[model samples]
Each structure stands twice: as structure tokens, then as C-alpha cells.
Target: METFDLSRLTDFDFEAVCKDLFEEELGVRLELFAAGADGGVDLRHLSSAGESLVVQCKHWHRSGRAKLIEHVENTEAAKVAKLKPQRYILATSASLTKGAKDKLFEILQPYVKTPSDIYGKEEIDALLRKRDHIVRRHLRLWLTSASVLNSLLAKNVVTRSQALAEEFDGTLRTYAVNPSYDRALELLESRHVCVIAGIPGIGKTTLSQVLSAHYMAMGYELVEISEDSDEANHLWNDELNQVYYYDDFLGQTTFDEKLAKNEDSRLLSLMKRVSRSPNKRFILTTREYILAQARQRYERLDRHSFDVHTCVIDLSDYTYQARASILYNHVYNSPLPQTVKQSFAEKRVYRPIIQHRNFNPRIIAVTLAESGLLSGHHESLSDDIVANLEDPYRIWDHIVRNQLGETDVKLLKLILTFMSDIRLDDLQELWMELGEPLRELRKALGVLDGTMLRSMHQYGAVHVGFHNPSVRDFLVNYVQSDIGEVTSLISMVRRFEQLETLWLIFPAPGGGPMAETYKRRRDQLEQVASMVFHAEPVNLRNSRHGKNYVRRAWLCLEMGLDLESEVIRELALEAASDADTILNASESTDLHAFFQTLARHKTSRGEEIMFDCISWAVEWIMGDLSDWNLIEEAEDFLRSIEHYDPGIEVSEALARLDSVRDDYAESAFEDWAQTHRDPVFSGSEMKEVIDHYKAIGSTDPFDMSEYDNVLQRLDEYDAGHETPFAAPRKDSAAGLAWNEVREVQSMMQTLRESSD
Candidate 1:
């Protein structure tokens, strides 16, 4: 008999768990009321005999038995008398003795009927033991069970899964189990693969963590793949039950070099293998936009139709109740003083936060964790929360500018130069090249770890990267706003990849805001072009190769730099005339870009060189249309040179590529038919799970009427507003900027005096 620490649940969570537990124990459907002014009725049921039965829940475990009796006698007895129900039942998380039940019965008279009608902590735990489904339904209860936590602690000792298990252990306390968790679990259970895709800060990674934890609790070995699918493949064990997690599998911001190294094909292969294996499970997460980009760029990935196994976590998945629970859990578990927590209970300070349009789980967590950072802002804690929610970017802005030291900021800027994680040794080398002391770099990394940056050890090397994509997004916005910052980044460039980062930031002339910023700073922009022209070219695999000159020429042209200049044109011609240099390049985008730059230049020699390169590319592509890479490269080359009247040979190659693609598509369909099957939990069992969920009613623990009213207004506002995601206006009471510092300090002093 496993007993849960019911103390882990919030007052509202406790109410919900009790509702489910009693529904099973009593075999009667109960209607739950809103949080406030329930008229001494937390739940009610009308018997077939027309008897009214009311149940009151008091989660006073911390208040002790004496306090519980006093509250029921002084406050609740009068309210119960007014209702005058035929039967009364009292439920509490507190452990009540027989004497206390008698005292309650004596207070309520005939309405109480019997002392057994009162369910205390002991009775509730016994009910939970008999009704296990109810316990499982409320994820907060089972996930925090002592057994599960102990399992997580034990698993944390394994090197392969230590980081992720530790992360899950820390986050499980505040995690609100929304519908996404169940959906992801079903997909992984059925298909053995689930790709979680969503916008940044939408709980994609968090959902993956929860799913991983679930499998871990079920006696599955956890393998976290940090870099690529090769790690998953290398660690594959058929005799063991294992769950593999690959966070941001595709790329964090852009198509990382890993994908360029043909990892997409390998990843697709691993997905196919996992789909056919019952003992293996794979979970991958990527930003929705990044996944979209990968599908468009990698033909094999697009053809595989990852959408079939993808569980996209969107804002719609979070209902009002779910949002409230998320916010409540964070606040309840935070280290805030008792007074500050009490302030949240006054006048429903949570109402505006629950209804905020930018209500993201990440934003909510950060606001609570970093609330102390806003002490200097001289606003109430509620105001600070709403302000941060209004503009999500501002959450990191103040932290970066005000709190970070000079060394920390520089280190962050250095990390920003790479699209994905940088090797610790490589980052240190770059740090030294930038004239920073090695000791300062270590200190900076230590300061930023677990806050703005994270370091992971894997594959015999330590890799450091941003803690989340939002940090990188913030740094990009930060640097683009300042011309000095942009020029400094260009001046500090040590690798061609860093230059590629700058090119992505200040893309061609039409790129939205950053392009405009670059256009305004033409001198700095020209310096970026000059740096690319003079810098040593490095290949995609991080090695020196002659083909890099072609990449450099292509990059300069894409930056809208004039390749027609005598010196620049000479370099372009020199790279283009070497047919071997163009033919050896792996990426078709690189080749297309180089030739496009040559054709745009339009010199007699450049045109002749471009024609030779296209002819050679067509021949190479025609030799092998079996692989999607070659077929895609052929299609891309033909499209790039179409304006130049690419001759009949190019048309012939495209026709052949089309035939190959059709065959591949048909073969892929056949493969899918052979592998895909109905979900393991489909039919009766799944319906039972869903029906049970619906019976539990709305999970919202707040005032139901108020929550519904606010949701209706939000819908109405969305209909008329151009930007539906805009933050709503706070109520007058919530908008007031009370002195939070004084309140916190005063509360601390009072607590100290009470202790004395």
C-alpha cells in the first residue's frame, strides 16, 4: 500500500483529488463549486430519494487538528446551519482523531448523521489505495509520491541520464499535468516515437521531460542524446527497456552543421527503427519554425511526414483551469515569505495573470523565480509580473544589462556567435583570442551556468550553450539595436561560422528589422563584408578546405555586397574557374549561391565560369538520383540557373529526378503501412481514460463564474483586436503600484519577531 504525501498538493489540488477519490468510494457523482464563498458546500450531490448531500473540504493539514475544529465551529457551523442539508460530510487533509469527529458532529447536530461521514487524512489515504485510477488521474499526486521521487533520485546516479533526471526531479514539483502529457504518452506508447514541436516558451521541452519521467517510473532505462541520433544508435540495447530523449533535435536556432553533415537521414533511420521496436521509445523536441525549416531543406525528412508522430503543444492546449493551476503551483512552491503568498490570495491577484494573453509557462516560472530582481523597480510584485508578461523579451533585458558583469556579457556574446552548443575548449580558445583572460572565462561560465547558460558533458567533451532559445533571441535583439555592438561582433569574429551567424542576423536587404538595422549602419555592414572577404575560410565540418572560398564568395553576394569590384570579382572568378573546387562541395545551397553570385556579376569570364560549373553539377547529379540529397541538389541547381536558360540537359535531369522521387514516395508509403499500427491504448481503454477525465469536471480550482466571465471577455476582445495576443488591461486594484520592497521587508521583520 503506497501512501502519497497529500501535503504535496495545493489546497485546490487536494480538493480535486478528494472529489475524484470520493466519487469512486461513494459511487455518486458530485458537483464541485468555485473556490470562494461556496456557502459551506465544496461539493454537493442529490440522491435518487431527493436528499441533498453536501460535502465540505478543508485542506488544513498544516493548521493542525485543534485549529481545524475551531475553524469548523466558529466559521463553518453557521454557514452549514443556513444550508440545512439532509446529510453533511466533512473532508480534510488533516489527520482527525475520533474525538475531533465527535466534536464536529456535536457542533452540526443531526445534519452530521454519523462520525464516519467525516473523512480525514487516514480515510482519504485508504480510499486512494482502493481507487488507484483516481490517484493516477491527478498527476500531481502520483508524480510526487515518495516511491517515484526515490526512483528519480536513484536514476540520477546513472551518467547517461543524470542531467535530464536531475532536471525532471527539480521541475516535477511545479509541473502541471495538462492534456499534452497524456497525448504524448499515448503516442510514445503506440508508435514508440513522439516529436514535440511548438513555439518557444510553450512547454515543449518540459512536456518531453515529463514524458521521460513517466517512462523512467515504469522501469525503463533513460538515455538522453545531447548531440545527434548517432548517440541513440550507439547506445541502442534490444534486451532492455529504454526511453531516449533528444532535446532540440533538429537545431536550436538555424539548420545547425549537424543537419548539414547529413544527420537528418540518420535521424530518420533511427525513428524508423524505434517505430518497429516495442522496448524502445524516442522523444525529440524542436521549435516549430526550426522543424518547418528542416522539412523544407531536408527532402528525406519532409518525405517521411514527421507530422504523423508529432504532438504540437500550442496555447489552446492550456485551458483557464490549467493556467491557474500552473501559476498557483509556482507561487505555492516558491521561496516567498508567507505574507507575500497571502497577498496572492487577497482579491484574486491571480485573475489577471491567468487571463494574460502571453501566459507562457516559461514566463510564469521566470517571473516567480526572478521576482526579487525587480526590487529596484519600486512596483508591487503583481505589477512586475504583469509587466514581464506584457513583453516576454523584457524578462531577460534587465537581467542582461543590470545584473551581468562585463565578463559575463562578453562570454554570452561569444556564445551567441555559434548557432548551437560550442565545445568548452573551443569557446575557451576563442575567449583567449579575444584578449580575455582564461580565468575570467571560467568565472563567467560559472556565473552564467543554470541561469543564462548551461554546460553539458557528453561524448568525451564539455559543451556549453544558452539555457534556452529565448536567451539567444534576447542577445540577437540586444546586439542588433546597437551599431557599436554589431561592429564589435564583426571585429571579434574568429571563425567563418561566426561570420555566418552575422549574415543570418543581418541577412540580405529584405530581411525584416535586423536588415533595416544593418542598412542604417552601412559602414559596419561593409566591414562585415570586408571581414568575410579577408577571413580564412573554414568548411562546414570545422576543417580547412579550398571549397570554403566558394562559401565566402557566396556569403558576400548574399549580404548584398558588390561582387563586381575588380578585387572581389577576381576572387570570385578564381574560385569558380577551379571546376574541381565547385564539384567537391557537399551542399547544393552553397554551390547554387556561388554560381548565382557569378551570374549576377555578368562579366564575360564570370558567365563562362558559371556555365562550366552548372554543366559539371548537372552531370554529377545525373550520375546519382537514387538519394534524395542528389535529387534535391539537382532540383536546386536547375532552379537557380533557370533564368540563365539552363539548357535541355538540365530539363532531362529534372525529369529523371521526378521519376526517382515518385518511386521513393511509393516505397515510403509501403514502409509506413508495414510499420504503423493502431495505438496500444486505443479503443476501450483509451475511451475509459478520456471518460474518466471528463467526469472529473473542469480542473480549474478558482472561482468558476469569474473564470468563465474573463474567458468570454478575452474571446470578445480577440474578435475585435488586430493583435489577439496583446495583454489585457489589469483591474484597478491590481494595477496599483504598492511598495513591494517595504511589504517584503515588513513581512520578514514580523516573521522574525514571531520567531523570537
Candidate 2:
């Protein structure tokens, strides 16, 4: 008979095994109590034929014989005496000596029918062998076949899976296992091909690994993606049940059609084969957008081919409970002190974390990890989480500013401009541009090997890019400073110039946007607005730099940075004449200051540039006709521009702005009065509202029927349905929002009755 390894059983599993063993071996049905709180009795056999017995189990596989005897005597004895059953029995997984058994009998003499009733490791092992099915049922977790282990080893899946599992082992212990895991298992069991799709970092890959580990532990052969496609073809001869895992199999974050044709087709072929073969399962993960792109570009990889077999779970489906549990897992397992961990586990602490806009598993893990590093910052930790949540670049900003060496920082900046398509040779050239020796360049590249830059096989050769898209995103937005006469902004601008050289140096090939080179070019332009706005103002004395500033100024305006864009606009105009004026300008430059410089223009070219600056400013200000001050500001700039070269375009545009501003102001007030029916406007405020329309050379031309609802509400108030001085919206539940409605109705009535 084979001996059982009771040490391999979890505490819960041990209790379960005991329940089954007693029912099967003794032919006595047993009742189990709640697991951890099972006070003393784990199994109860209640029947007239069996004299009502209570069995207590000690799953102390690691305890010494002396400790086991002590527990049986003191704890088990007291509980058995309290229960006062007709017979008492103690069961334990501990291997006991003769002296220990004698001591336990002496301790429990009064409680049990006999000391022989106590069953130790030998008896339990005998029961396990007599009922072999019981052992198999309870100890299945340890029953993996040697062939499955060999298969995992052959594919090198053992090492990689172990590393990934350990990375999350601590956190997974606390993770309230998501229901989707079971749902995924069921789908894969029936269909054999499960595609777990979601946004990046939303647990697709994590879920895949979890399922992979689960099925692998269930004695399935593990087949993984290989560099050689021939290995997938060899899997056709497999006889055992197989589980194949291909993470990011379709593509990384987004799909590239060329890569789909060259590489992903092999995986697709393997999946098709798996669908037809018995006892085979295929599990893959991809970003939702990437999957969509793949389906569109590669017809052979059509999702319709495996329609019912696919399962998609996304962030949108995560409930508050699920999100909170995910956060709790990381926070509980974080390396923070015990007290800190307890505080973080509090409902109040994690409540905000779940409700936060950036609440996701990836962010939760990163935030908790970063929080541990930022000691004594509990008060501001939530705020910091919010800031970094809004802009994930902040996390990267923290890393780059604090972690990277000087050479690494320079290399990172150059690589950011290159985006993901950064070539080794180009990196060498860009690194050399810093005037560093060839040896120093090689040393810098060596340092970046595993941290940020990674090797990617594409375009028929190996190339280097960011390890992931997030790293590139962070590095591109991040700016580091050094103590120097020049601002870091000017240095960043020079970097952009270097990026321009890359385009001429290596023109991108024609393809879709997902292509690496195309993405790099796209990211360069995409980051320009943020880069310019984030950088400090540079003295634009040179005409070329002035043009550059002017270009960015317009781009900022287009980006809805109205106030900042205008500030840069005026600075660029001043820098055209004297760059010192830009450095001299105060933070709060008024509308008069904006036009004052235009009056001092000497040459027509200078006047033209200044006029163009004023024109752009007025256009932006007048774009939104609601700002009363912008109309007055445009009037002032128009008056100043007349002294230089005020043409029909300027005069007509200014006249149009004046007309629109007056009309917009009157209409805006009317709309405000209608929306805000509050009766809080003082007598002077009402008179001011009337006089304001008159000053704009227009009467209150709005129709009074729009106030019908407010009038009806006022009638309700006057009819004593509500008090005149009732609290705001006191009758709201009664369907009368009297405060604002009454107020607006009174104002409109007073305006019509009162003469202007």
C-alpha cells in the first residue's frame, strides 16, 4: 500500500480529506463545520447506531511529536470534555512516538472511551491506502505526471512560468480570485481555444498565466510559442492532453500587418489545428484594439473562425468589489511594515484607491510599490496617486529624475526622440553626437540592456526599442534638468531638432500606422505640443528660433491652451525685436502690454510680424465671444495697431469682434437668467443687469415664454404652496424649484415693467 504525504495538503484540504476518509473507511457519514472557525470538532457522526461521536483533527504535519501530544491533551481534551459526547476521537497527521502517545492518553483519560480511539499518522495512512479514490480526490494537486513535467521542461516553459508565477505569488495569496478565472476555465474546457482580450494592463496576460498554471498543474502538456515555427507542427503527433499558451500572440498592444503575415500566421495555424484535435486547449491574450486590427488585416486570423470558442473580458466589466479586491491583494502583500499594511487594508484607505479614476490592477501594483518607497507621505499619497493616475508619465518622471545616471539620461532623451524604431547604429550616432568617445557610447548602451531598451526581432533583423510602450511614453514626456546657465527647455528643443535629422537620415517606408517607423514619426509629432508647453521659455533672439516659437505658439492655440498660447505669442513678437524683453516680461502681462510693443515697430517686416501676432491673439480671443474683457482687449490692440499698419482685414476683423462680443454678452446674460432662477439678486444687481443690456445698445430681446416654468413655480409660491423665504429648493420634492424659478420670473417681470 502506498503511504500518503499528508504534508502536501492545505489546512482546508486536510479537513476535507478527513471528512471523506471517515465516511468511506468507517462507513459513518460526517458533518463538517465552518473551516477556520471549527472550534474543536471538525467531523461529527450523529446517529443512534454510532453513539454520537465527535472527531477532532490536527493537521500539524510540521509540528514535533511533543507539540502534537500537548495540543491533543490540553486543547482537544478540554473541547471533548465540554462537548461530552458518548465517545471522543482525535485524528492527526503528526507522526507520534510511543511515549508521546502514552502522555496524550494520560492527558485525555477522562474525555475519551479509550486511548486507542486516538488515530495517529499510521492509522490515517492505512485509511488512505484502503480507500485509494479518497486520496486521489483530495490530493489531486500533487498528482502531476512525469510526462507533463518533461513536456514543460522541453519547451523551456518551466523556468519562465515559475518566474512569472513567483512575481505575483505573494500578491496572489491575498487576491480575491476573480470569477472570470472559473469562467475562462469552463470556456477553454468546452471549446479548447480561448482568447482573453482586454485593454493593456487589464489582467489579460495575468489571467492567461493563471489558467496556464492551473491546467499545467492538472497534468496537461505545456506547449509555448517558439522562435522556430516547425515546433508547432510537431505538436500534431501529441497523444496527451495539451495546453498551449501564447501571450501577446497576435501582436504587441497594436497589430502590425507585416508581422501578422510573417510571424503570427504560424500561431494561427496551430490554433486551427488545436480546434480540430481532441484533448487540446489553446489560450492566447491580446489587447482588444490589437485583436480588432489583426482580424481586419489578416483574414486567416478571423475571429469568426473560432467564434463561440473565444472569451473576452475587459476592464469595463470589473465591479467595485473586484477592483477593490485586486487593489487589496497588492497592498496587503506590499513590502510596507505591518502597521502600514494594516492601515492600507482598512476599508477607508482602499475605498479611495478603488474609486480613483486610474484604478486598475497595473496602477494599483505600481502605486502601492511606489508608496512603500515614499515613507512619511501618507497624507499626500492619495493626491500623488491622483496626479500620477491622470498622467502615468508622472511615475516615469519620478523614476527618470531619481534613478538614471547622467549618461543614461542623455541616451534616454535621444531614444525618446527616435521613439520605438530606434536602431542600434542610429543610437550609436546619436550617442556620439554628445561628443563622447566610442567606448563611452558602448558602455552606455550596455547599461541600458535590461532596464529600458530591449531587443526586438523585426524587419528581418534584430533591432532595439523601448521594453514596452509605457516606457517610451514616460521617457518622451519626461524632462530632467541640470544646474547650468541655459534652461532645460532649450536643451529639449535641441533634441527635437535632432529628431528632425532622423527623418531625413532614415525616411520611413510606406505602410499602415501600426508599422514601427510610422509610429515613431507619429509619436514625434504627437508629443510636440506637450513638449513645447512643458518646456520653459527660451530667448528667441535668432530669427530661426523666433519662427520656431511662433510655430509652437500657434500649435498651442490649436490645442486649447488659450492663455498659455497667447503668452507665448506676445513673447515671440517681443523676441523678434529684442529677446531680452521676453526674459523681462512679468507673469501677469495685461492686454495693454500686449499692444504697447506694436506701436514701437520701426521696419515693416517687424511691424508685419507684430501685426500678425496681434491678429492671432485677437482671433483666439474673439473665437469665444463670451469673454467681455476680450472684446475690450481687442479694441485696445486695434487702437494700437492703427498707429502702425492697420489694413481692411484688421479693421473689419475688429469690427466683427466688437459686434459679436456685444451680442454674445446680451444673449449670455439672458441664458444665465433663465438657467439660474434664484431670487438672490439685489436691487442694484438687477439694475446693473438692465443697464448692462442698454450699454450694449440692445434691449432684453429674449422671449418671456422661456420663463413659463419659472412663472408657474412663482405662482405656486404666491399661492402659499411654499414659503416666500423657504430654503433653496425647499419644495423640490413637491415638483417646485421655487428659489431660482421665482427669482428669475421676478427679474424678467421687473425688467419689462421698469424703464431703462
Candidate 3:
């Protein structure tokens, strides 16, 4: 078929061809009119503001191939002609052939027509695909007309879609588990606000996002509203409220803590407004239990014949399908052993697929990609780049100190200090027991349970959470200088001991630990086999109290208490069972259990359980384990507690532990030295840090830095000349956030330096 040029047709048909091409791709429609009628230009285009290049196509396509050249030549001669329109496009259906393209370029070039390469081959083909299409020769003749091509440069036509790049990720799979997927699809197909709730890791949040994305793509308006961000306003102006995701909102707090009720009121009003509209729609995500408890204020979700629905998605059953899905997601994208996947798939050996707390798709992707677990998979695409997710500790630091204004930064330090898969009872008890510094700290941060608490053990419902391990590692390792602390307490203590060992390389600090004096301390430590690890926990005080007796048991266990395994296990059981000290006492129990189980089965009648037997025989002689007394002269009595007095003296105990601070990281010692060294920090920052600490664990405020390993890391890091101002977030309930105040501070610093 020969391509058409506008000149071959009557003005009416030429306008029709232009309209057809414009509407096909740009969704544009234009009107035909005489030259003099003007308003908003001759041709207009629709684009979401700031982006359209609207154009007015003119000239002709017809049997004027020869005369059209004469007209073009004549128009060039009248360079100053006033009759031309402001922006005229001489577009033609016949795409300029490679040969003709050169000739037109020369003839149009000398005249400064700014040749509008506006016509695409597809558009030309579309126009010429039908009957009465202007022939190719006529198309070229029309485009060459001097009246049209000359005035084309100033025009444009913009379309909305072209301006915005597709920012959505497409290759990944997103799924909502069954029964619920079935229910949700019904709700969506009919357009409903679905309220979903379940225990942590049951996939409520993921389902909300996926549903919202799916329906929104299907042309339903969807928004994600939350306490974390004001996404609710996104749907406010719409009369056609289609679907919405209000995530993690519980009823407003009765009191003003971190969030004021005013914002909640505003949100409530917005939700109501959306509901009142005949076309309003939404999906509410919150602890339904909490919502149900609230006295009815806003309309009940089921108020209508109800386009809305409510459902709880619990994963307790772990149906084979769900288990398989979870397993595939984990190992398919994880760095686990190949046999792990094989075992899971074969179903020959039942392997309990441990669900990582980070059940979101991104984390799953990261876990799989980083572990290179997809290596043997028969069908799996190579993983996308693994994003370095923000470290939860660092984000938490931003939250508590930067956002919340509770600068003591204790709650985070407490968590960082006392961690390792912990039981829920032990966690709560420690929060209640040793909460001297952390008590107020926890309340201030609003860790009020639920989202902040997580289950670490295979859900006997026993829980433990200290942020994701990766986030914690980031704070302690990647941004060490910024945090100036490792959240891991044991690690901090080891580092401190290391620093002290290094300092020991120098002559004992003046009169301190005179080579012989410190050596005696070393000898005393050596006398106890548990001290073999250099961190031997031996009770030096008289063993009078039950707690001290347990400590002695722990010491024996650590020292290869072969004979005393049963005794230690029995004793450690109470401590472990004592919700108050389990987190801080689990190591002893685990060590005790290991030996006790071994001794019970392996001890032949003639073979002696030396360590266990000795400890038990000794315990028999001491009628009361807590009956140890201390001599008045003992200044440092933590060790002597079991042998002498078990009670810890407030200041004196701190002073001795203060001395031990030298054994930690040099940075810690330096932070302590410089902090106390600065008369003010000792009076304030140090006081606050410790007070917050004591609130979390029941230790003295001053003793906070002593007890929390992370605090020591932060201190050492601070003393090491790292940025001490930033700390971990105290609460993970809200997504960690940071904004301009600090950025501007940094900016000013830069500006000031530039001025200098």
C-alpha cells in the first residue's frame, strides 16, 4: 500500500488521519479549523503537567509531487512571509525513503526548516494500511511544501505515560497463602476493605502490600496508610475510594507518649470521610484484638451489607503446601547446604524448616541470593542485587536518640548487651529484675510488647529479639566508628579484656597492678579452673545465699565439673527456671545440662564423676549455700561473695568493677577516662547513660556501663574518637527515620569550612 500525505486528501480527511495516529499512541484527539481561528494554539496534547510537546501537523499528501517541489522552492523565496502558522508540521504517511531522506534534508536544510523528523514508520504504516491512503509520491510532495515544513519546529505533543519510567519491580513473585488468597480475591474482585490480622510472621503485612499493588494495577485506587507514614492522605481527595491498606495501627493510645492523638483524630476523620462517600473503600490492618476492644467510635467495619470483610490469617497448621512454600522460599534463595534443600524436598527425612523472622520478600530474596543456595536449582533465575538493608540497630539509634529525644540511648544498649536466643519469660523477667537503668528506658521507648518482641526459639511461644542478626552486625562491624559500640556484650567484654592485656604490655599504670600485684590476681584466677577462659566466673564471697550457691555450681560446671554435673544441673535449673535471671544465666544451664546428661549415662559403677561428686560433697557440708560471710576489709567483693559476703556494696562494688573497666576495650577505657575525665559527662551524659541502663536491667545507673557490653563498646568507640552522638534506636515499633536537622548541621559545617 502506498503511504498517504496530507495534501492528497481534502482538509477533512487529512485531519482524520492526524487524529487517528495521535489517538493510537498518545490518546490525543484534535480539531480541524481555518488558519485565523486561534485559542490555546492550533493543536493541543494532554500530559500530566510540565511534560507535553504539543504539535500542529499541516501541509499535504496528494498528486502534487512535481508542483509540491515548486511550492517548496517558492515558499523558501518568501523567507519573511507573514502568513505561516506559528508551529506547522508537514508530516506525511510515506516515510522518507533512505534516498529521498537525503534530498529532502538538503532542500529543507538551506531554508532552516529545522526538519521535523516527527513521523515514525509505525504511524505511517497505520495511515497507509487502508484504502484512499494518499500514494507515497503524493506524501513526499505534500511534506516538501514550503508552507508547512517551515513552521514546524515550535510544536510538541506530550503523553503522560512516556514521562514516568516504570519504577516497579516485575520479575519477583508475590503470593498470599491459600483460603486467604481465595477470600482476598473474592473481596478484591468485588472491591472490599479486608481487615487482616495474625501473630507475628504469619504474613499479614506482606499480604496487605501485595493485595494493594495487585488491585491498584487493576485500576482500583489503593493506598497504604500507617502510623509510620501519612499515606492515608493519599486517598483523601478521592471520591472513588477503591482499596486501601492501613497497616499496623492499633487504637490510639489513651495517653500522649510518643504519638499524640491529634494525628489519630485526623486519620480517623479521613477514614470516615472515605467511608461516608458512597464509593469509598479501604483495607484496615491492625491488631483486630485491640480494635475489637475499643468501644465503638467510628463505624463498625461490618456496618454495611458490607463490601468489606474481616479475616485472621494464622499459620499454626503449617499445612504441607504452606511448609513447602516456606521451605522453597528459604533454601531456594538462601546460602544453606545443598543437602539441606535435598532433604527438604525428598521428604524422606523430615527437616523442620526454620522460618526466619524476616519473612518479607526482600529478606527472603537476600537470604537466598547471599547464601548462593540457588546453585543447584533446576529452574531459578539468578538473583537480583542484594540490597544492604538498613541495619536495625543503626535505624533504632536514629529513632531513640535522633527522633525520640531520649538521648541516654539505653534500651538499645540493653538489648545489644544482653542477647543471644533468649526465652520470653527470661526476657520479661530481666526487664523486671535488673531493670534499674532500663525500666524507664523501656517505657520511654514504648516497647509495650507485640511488634517489638519476637520469638527466637522454635515457637513454644518463647521469644527473643535483638533486631535481625544482620542489622546488629552492621552496627557493630560495618559502622563501628559511628556506633562506637558492638551490640554484643560478650564480644565487648572480650575486647575489653583484650585491651587490658594490651595495656599490660606497658609498665603497670604507675602504682596500679605492680607486676607482682597484678600477677597475684592472675594467680588467684588461675587457681579456679573456670578462669581458664580468662573470664572465669568464680564467687569469691562466702556462699551464703541460694543465688551464690548457683554461681558456685556454674563455676564448677565451667571447670569440668564431671562429678558435680547432676548437682550443677539441679542447682542451675532453679536459676534457669527463675525467669528473673535466665537470660543472664542460660550459659550455665546449657553447660550444666551437657555434662549432667553425659555423666548420667556414661558413668559406669566403678568410674567416678570427679567434678560432680566433689561439688555435691562440699554442698552437703555447707548446710546453707547462702551462708557465706565477708571480712570488713574486702573493697572488691564480687568474687568473694560466695566465700564471704554475698551482698554487693553500692559504691564500693562499682569502684572495683570500675577498675575492671581497664580490662575492656581501650576505647571503653578511654571513653570512661575521658567521660569521668570531663567533670561534666560524669555528672550528666554518663549519669544518663547509666541511669537508663539501670532502668533496663536493675543494675545501678553508674553500673550500667559496667553491665551492658554494648555500652562499653559505645564508650570505647567514643573514647576511640568515633562519632559518639549517634546511637541505636531504642524502639523498632516504628520504622527508623532520619531527616534534615542533622543534614543541615553537616551542611553548615561544610559551609563554615569553605568560608574559612
| C-alpha TM-scores of all predictions | 0.70, 0.47, 0.27
Per residue, candidate 1 scores C-alpha lDDT tens digits across 690-728 of 232346663232333444443344344333322112111
TM-score of 1: 0.70
Error of 3 at 659 (Å): 72
Output the lDDT of residue 435, model 3. 38
TM-score of 2: 0.47
Q: Give the per-residue lDDT digits (tens) of candidate 3, residues 691-736.
A: 4335556343243445455455445534443211211123310111
Reference-based lDDT, each prediction? 0.68, 0.51, 0.35
Number of backbone collisions per candidate, in order?
A: 0, 2, 74
lDDT of 2 by residue, 621-662 (tens): 445444443344455445545554465656777779756755
| Candidate number with the higher TM-score (1 or 3) | 1
